[model samples]
Target: MDVDVLIVGAGPTGLALGIDLARRGVDALVVERGETLAPGSRGKGLQPRTLEVYEDLGVLDEILAAGGAYPVGMIWTDGEQVGRHAMFDPAEDGEEGSRFTGPWMVPQWRNQEILLARLRELGGTVAFGREVVRIGQNAEGVTAHFASGAPVRARYAVAADGGRSAVRRALGIPMAGETLDPDRALVADVRIPELERTWWHVFPPSGPDSGFLALCPLAGTDQFQLVARLSAGAEPDLSPEGVRKLVAERTHLAPEAVTELLWASDFRPRAALADRLREGRVFLAGDAAHVHSPAGGQGLNTSVQDAYNLGWKLGAVLGGRAPEALLDTYEEERRPVAEHVLGLSTAILRAEARRGAATRQLGLNYRHSSLSEETRRDPGPLSAGDRVPDLTVDGVRLFDRLKGPDWTLLTLDSGVFLVRPDGYVGWAGDTEDGLGTYRARVGLG
Candidate 1:
């Protein structure tokens, strides 16, 4: 076998999963089609839940140091401020096991850099410019054929490739769901007038039907990224006047005030999920498994979460410590979550289409799981299944408890609960009630 695991694509999802696999001492290799790591800012905001995952990977401090912090949430249509509802801060509520207290605003490229550096520090490097042409699998292992006519074998394979995944297609997996609508949205990084004071502005100067604008403050006031949702019918022209007119209609800015235009491209919102996240020994993650509207900034976050869910399971199974059935749970757990999240984003878009005034956000609540059953109440406002409320536990906070890439096993009073690496409780009966059996089931024995 070429390695224990082969990861295709070196974007956020691929790199994050590579970091986890390397930390677990798993022999892994990541392949990317791009020769150089992407530098542009496709995704800018890191949700609280994703920040918590980065904290667990032992890189949150580095991430914060590299990126700026934004504590405030959405500025409502009525101009009311809605905070991020502190999920990982100890000073505010003193919740144990909480690490990331709020959401963060960091360019997606920076986050990928951190993950890539961590992977290299752990003695693993992503092989860029080397795309996989095809893949074949059998009972022994899986083999990936490269564009250079070289075949690499591994015990298992994971397709972290982007939305248009060649690996997924080679495996003949059907991606079932919606595609981009007729509307076309343009994203461009530019120098706007009076920047760096605010992180994001949803209400556009052009009005709601004209689509909202997202202003991302970069390193200085002179530099910023302005992502606006333009009409699908907007002519595709990068001329100064063309760009100026769009910005003017949205922000009422003067032509010269727009200053410089860096990069401009058009894309549409799409919602899709693979018929199945796994087929035999090859598994799919990130955009390969699902795609959705970028309204809630959950696209990249969801992909990273997908990688987080699959990484440790792949490690455990390859290391002979876990049954293959454990790998099946990845789809069982994340597919439903993706479906729910995509549906919510679609609803938000529909609402936005009608110029409705609703604070758009994606809330993840696992009320369907067994561990969440303990609460026994609908996840109204807040509940146990809702990202496991960050609370203080005997001075060791929940976020702090996620200091490494290992099972957490958090209990109300240390009652022998079993947690998976992805932060899901596998078994949570009682401390005195067959701990060994539960441990065996969780591969912790």
Candidate 2:
């Protein structure tokens, strides 16, 4: 085999997974069609749960240093300040895991860069400009045939190639989708000189059925992410001139105040889930497995979580520590989570629900997952299949102990509990009765 695993994208999902595997000493190669990392301000919100995943992957410090908190939203009308709105639910000081209470605003490009750097530090590399055109797998391994290069073989492969996944199509896997919005929307990153960075500026349309505009300051950068809702049948212009004209016409900012247009794109909002996340020796992750609406900031965070969920499983099986059945649980667990998260993002996009509790994604859990074994007669707030909250246990932070690629047996607060490497409780009970059997089953010896 050319490598142990072949990752078919270098976005946040692929890079994050690469970091996990590299740290576990797994041989994985990430291949990207683009020569460089994707350039965009999209997927800016890194939710709290994903922040914990980063903490384990060894990139949380860099991620925190490179990003900032979300600013409040400011409404404007006829070039006059109208109202103020909170971007997310506020958190109290000293709250449990308050350090990761809300979403962090880091551009998608910067997040990818940080993950890639960490992957490199762990001796993992991404091969760019190698797009897969065909994929064939047998009992031995999977072979990915590229457009401009020789075929590469691996024991397993992953499709992290975005919403329009070539590998998914090559596998003939169908994607079920729901259209959240028929109207087109423009998403871009721009440098505005006169705009204040303290607030995310919003402007309602001046006329009936007209477009609305919002400019949000990107953390740790002078660039602002500009989003505008377009009228039905209106084609979006991604050019710099078009971006400046849109801002000047819709907001109080002058054309020249929009100093530069960094990156831009247009798309109709929608949510989609693949028919299945796994097929034979290959698996799907990120936008390849599920797509989400831009609202609620769920897409990228969910995608990264997908990688976190699958990475350790792959490492365990490839390292000969766990049974192959462990791989089946990846879909069994993450698929439902993706479906629920899609519902959340779509609800916000359709105005059916406000971006509140669900958008934070802190409450998402695997209680219903078959892999989660709750032996307690009545579980507490942190249960089997639940995210292990960060708490100070005897002077050491729970997260600090859970760091790195190893399952931790937390025998405090709760009785004996087996916490998975991704910070979820795998088994919990009032006592250590079945700990030995469970450990042997999951190869935790």
RMSD each, Å: 5.3, 1.3
Query: Which 10 consecutive residues of model 1 have the lowest summed lDDT?
Result: 353-362
Where does candidate 2 clash, by residue pair?
none
Determine the backbone clash count of candidate 2.
0
Error of 2 at 237 (Å): 1.1
TM-score of 1: 0.83
How much is the lDDT of residue 213 in candidate 1? 60
Stretches of candidate 2 exceeding 4 Å from the true structure: 94-98
Cα RMSD for predicted model 1: 5.3
